[model samples]
Target: MARWRIWRPRSRAVPFLSLLLLAPLVFTGLKAVNKIGLSSERNYSRGHVTFVTVFTTYNSDPAEASKLPSNVVTVGKHSYSKVGRSMAILNTFIGFIQVSMPRSNVIILTDPNSKLTHGSAVILPIEGNYSRGNLMLQRIRSYIAFLEQRLEELETVEDINHLIFTDSDIAVVTDLGHIFEMYPHCHLALTFRNNKGQPLNSGFVAVRGTRDGIFKAIEFFKEVLEAYHLKYMEASRMLGDQLALAWVVKSYLPSAFSKFSKHEAFTVYNWTPPEGAGQFHGMPLDVK
Candidate 1:
């Protein structure tokens, strides 16, 4: 009878075909497990996230108006004696935020004279010229200051690790804590509008809490502030904050910023909504 022998592979260093095939399955399985864990509230923690927004009070006081920046003074604009629409919207925004992300911290950067108060949100007084052109610059400054302060505080305290700055009009429909896990390497995330002329919508910005991330964020904002102050052209100031942000990201930090998805930037109007977009009558997807 002929002797039967098992065939042996020439190279033992090569991985087994079975193991190679299983590698992808194992990786995919691990990814699915991580996604499930992140979605579960019991497994995920939201204490590390802090939401920030600026609520500029409509100050009619002559004294406060006097503090306007030189650019505002040059424009000769009247004080907004009657301004309530945005505030009403902001209050509604806060209500949604409180209900959706109760565990996360919310900080409202408002004028010292702002009467708007919230039970859960921390009202941080940001002193600056809240004029149309100057407001954007001040907002950037406020973010920088807050980041710097938090970095200092983080030396001893370690409760927070991410800061999400958004426009007051944006309403939260769900907890955004999953973003950190989803974009593990993202240091800064900015929402983009479809318009190429003014691509970056400063409506939402997410900053990581690492020292490098904070510094990069600060640097980028400082460049934005400088652009506003310099006013490359008279039109630069008139084009609004979005243009300035786009210019900064393109010119200074093209690779430094990541983008939020269409779902995250689902606005009520202005830009075209994505397919199967749900009704935002109650601020459901303002900034998810």
Candidate 2:
């Protein structure tokens, strides 16, 4: 019973369109997809930031992960890793930043009773109750915003300047302190595609959490959600968040839910996946 609104493209080639997607400005369980907030001023000192905000959502509980699994959880072979996923990312992402942003705040959205060997990990719960969003892509669409908005609920958003949002699997070999400087302009920064020209990897994305930056991210997932209502798209598409994310950013239709023209409103990072293919471009990124 979602509401419908008409979105007419400025171009004449695109006729009329109405999407039956009603994104609530306020969500209950996990914060709603469109309820973005902007403070009048930053909470922390901007220049030469000593503390950085970093968070990642991890639902390792078998019951939770089974509900919605990412490409990393499903095929499990995307990243160049052996013996499943290693703990290298935790050390690299948080450890490497100590050189510049020493007091980095690392929050992981995981199950309630999870244990951690890393003394620095701050544990938060990632609820698996995604309604009918049991599919992986649906999980990605629902949770990406949850991760962003949860920060707002904690009241710690304004206290931090740049949010270095990254996936738990990404292994950082070099110091990426400079990438945060793009917050003023890029809003969100991440690798655009892989050498094979795949879609944007949802694994790692840096959102600026400003008036427009966080708004774009939460709204971006709202658009990806339009695919869930399509009778043609399969549940398997949900296996990877990137495919759904790509479609949400580029899709154009009177019945579709994309907001901007192409991807003009994004900042592509320099890092690309070690390997991948573009066979799924313009379509859902899935294994079929």
TM-score of each: 0.64, 0.50
What value of lDDT does candidate 2 attain over all alpha carbons? 0.41
lDDT of 2 by residue, 83-172 (tens): 123344455656644433444456655433443335666655554443334444434543565546655754654444445555554434
Predictions in order: lDDT: 0.55, 0.41
Highest lDDT model number: 1
Model 1 segments more than 4 A misplaced: 1-47, 60-84, 232-239, 252-287
Model 2 misplaced regions, further than 4 Å? 1-89, 99-101, 113-117, 129-157, 174-177, 180-183, 195-197, 228-239, 252-288
Model 1 residue 219 lDDT score: 67
Model 2 pairs in collision: 17-254, 137-238
